[model samples]
Structure formats: C-alpha cells, structure tokens
Target: MNQEHDAGPGRSGVSRRNFLGGGLVAAAVTPLLTGQAEAKAAAAPTVDGVAQVTVRAAVNGSPVTVRVDPRATLLDTLRERLDLKGTKKGCDRGQCGACTVHVDGRRVLSCLTLAATTTGREVTTIEGLADGDRLHPMQQAFVEHDGLQCGFCTPGQIMSAVAMVDDEGGADSDDEIRERMSGNICRCSAYPRIVDAIRDAQQVMR
Candidate 1:
C-alpha cells in the first residue's frame, strides 16, 4: 500500500538545493544590509558632540595654529589639518615608524602623540628635510643608494636616519645603525642599501 502524507501548506519540505539557495540569498543580503547601515551611520555628522582644541606649534619651520579634536593625534593633525602628507599613517599604533617625526629634534611616533601635547614645540616633518632646491644629505644618499622600493616608508626612515646621525650614537657602525633603525620597518626589505645610505650620509653630514 502506497500512501502519500502531505506536508502542510506552511510546512512544505525543503530540498537540499532549495536550502542551499536560501542560505546563499541570506548571506548575500546580510552584507548588503550591513553596508547600508554602516553607510548611513558614517553619513551622520559626528563633530557636533566631540570637543576640539586649538594647538599651536612650529611645523616645518613655520609657525602655525590649528584646531583639532582633543583625541586627534599629531600624525592626523599634520596630515589632515596642516597638509603635511609626508608623514605617513602606517599601523597607527606606533608599531610601524611610518609616522615618525622630529619633535624638538627628537624622533617620536606622531601617531601615539596627541596634537595638543605638541603645543609650543618645534615639530619637524619630512617636508622640512630639504632646503629649498637642495635635498638633505640623508635624503640624497637614500636616492643614490636606491634605499627605497615602494617609498611609502622612506620619509620616516630618512627622518629617523637624520635624527640618528644627529644623536651621534649609531650611525658609525653597521650593526649599530641597524639596531637603531630597526624601529623603522621597510617592508621592501631594502636593509643593506638603507644601511649603506646612512653610512654615506653620515660621512657627508659630518
């Protein structure tokens, strides 16, 4: 005896293909809905509630003042507000030295430094490394030695090299220079050329 049992109208059996199709549809729609919600949230004005403060500092030998959020970092203020794009935003957590800059002649990670804390201090960026038509010796050496590949990390590497030379601690020896410059990461892995450039520039800088 063959008897067919009807699965109720609201409880129709789902085939494997139908189940997979339904899952795929749900997965595609989820991302679309998430993106739309994120876009809407991002479109909303956010400055209305955040506090901003004025920070005064000498940037690249020019006296300047800018208003920034209290939580804004020196790297953001330099790149966004002051239009100094040479200081790159990499890692943004101080792990990568791409945001390296000189504050009062000392190398510091700009991303970890608060913009407000730099008030009344001399902040030197990569743009200030050159003198009019003449590039800094370290910069020239970097170019001559082909010390960079992608060049995104060159500015920070050069800045840190200049400071290292000025500090007169590690520029003399390859091992020392490598140790000192380890903070600056060049994903291009141009280590040998970078060391050579620093050594060459150290001689000319002296």
Candidate 2:
C-alpha cells in the first residue's frame, strides 16, 4: 500500500527538500510582516489641545523622567505607569480623597492634575511617605488609632494627613483636622479615628 501510494504520478517525487523549499516561500515574506509591524509601532497618535512633552520629576525622592500626555491625570500616570500602587484611584474625577499626593510638600488631588504640567515639581505619593523600616508618623498614628477598615484609602489618607500636619493644617483642633481632611473621605466611615490619628501624628511630628 505504501509502495503504491509513493509510486503515484505527481507524488512519486516527494522529498524533504521539496517540502522545505515550499515552506521557505512563507518565511521569505517575513520582511513584509516586519515592515507592517514597524509601521504599526511607528503610527502617530492624535493629541487634542494638549502638548506632549517629557518631564523629569523628583518622585518619592527619586528622579524619574517620563513622556507624559498633557491630558493624562496624575493619578493614572503614577499608578499605571510609575508603579506607585500606594496611591489609590477611589474617584477618577477627584470626588474622593483616595488619590491625594504631595506636590512640593503640599497635598494635592492627583486625579485632577495633569501629568505634563507637574514637570520639575516634587511629586510624592504614599509610597514616599514611609521611612526605611519605620513608618511615617501619620502611618504609625493611623495604625495606633485604627484609621482604616478595608485598607484601600489608607495610603492617601495618611499621606494627606501628614502633609496637613506638616503645614499646621491640623493645629486648630480635632474638628479642624476633620474639616481640613474632609476632601479625603474614608469609605469605611472611619472619620473619627482618622481625625484622631491625624491629631496624634501631629504631636509626634512636631
């Protein structure tokens, strides 16, 4: 049966070389494939009324240069690209306080700021709030006062509180701290402990 099949007219001359030679035809088109891939990669993307520029920023005490889209929010730029997961994205439109970060020692809502405009400024997130082996005073206070329930918004809350206390925003009283930090809400409704932790941390930080 094998001999009869092999002896067939057009199949009589089947060889490894013939099969391999046919395969080379597809492989030879790889240059075309590569060109298309390059074209796709180099395709220009449209930018609206925004300028795209590279900025070198001191992030978390470390200098990093990144090409930022003018419309990209600071929260998305840091968490998605810079791998700063400590900054939460509670409300992308800046309603919640979960995306707070420090801009040159002052706390700002990262979800509302554009990444391109923050060039050359110091941007510090919750990841930058802690010291080596020792947590920041705010973090310690939060832990002591149980300021978190689900632990999702804790980083931004602590970071904002730290900046507030450092800036004497919490110097008035517990009510003042609560009012000042009202922008950063704890979804767990842990407002009392949050205020207490800020007050506690302010004393230690002073």
Best of the candidates, lDDT: 1
Per-residue lDDT of candidate 2, residues 1-206 (tens digit): 11222322235566523543311111211222122343343322223323344546788987776555555677877876677788998977788888999998998998888876787899999888778889988899999999889988888898888888786546678778877888888788988888888888898888
- Residues 43-93 of candidate 1 have per-residue lDDT tens digits of 212232444455668888877765555666888778766668999999988
lDDT of 1 at 193: 97
Q: Which stretches of candidate 2 lie over 4 Å from their true place?
A: 1-51
Could you list the CA RMSD of all candidates, in the order they appear?
15.8, 16.3
The residue-level lDDT of candidate 1 at 31 comes to 21
Clashing pairs in 2: none
Q: After superposition, how far is residue 100 of candidate 1 from its true place, in Å?
A: 0.5
Q: In candidate 1, which residue pairs get closer than 3 Å at backbone N, Cα or C atoms, i.e. clash?
A: none
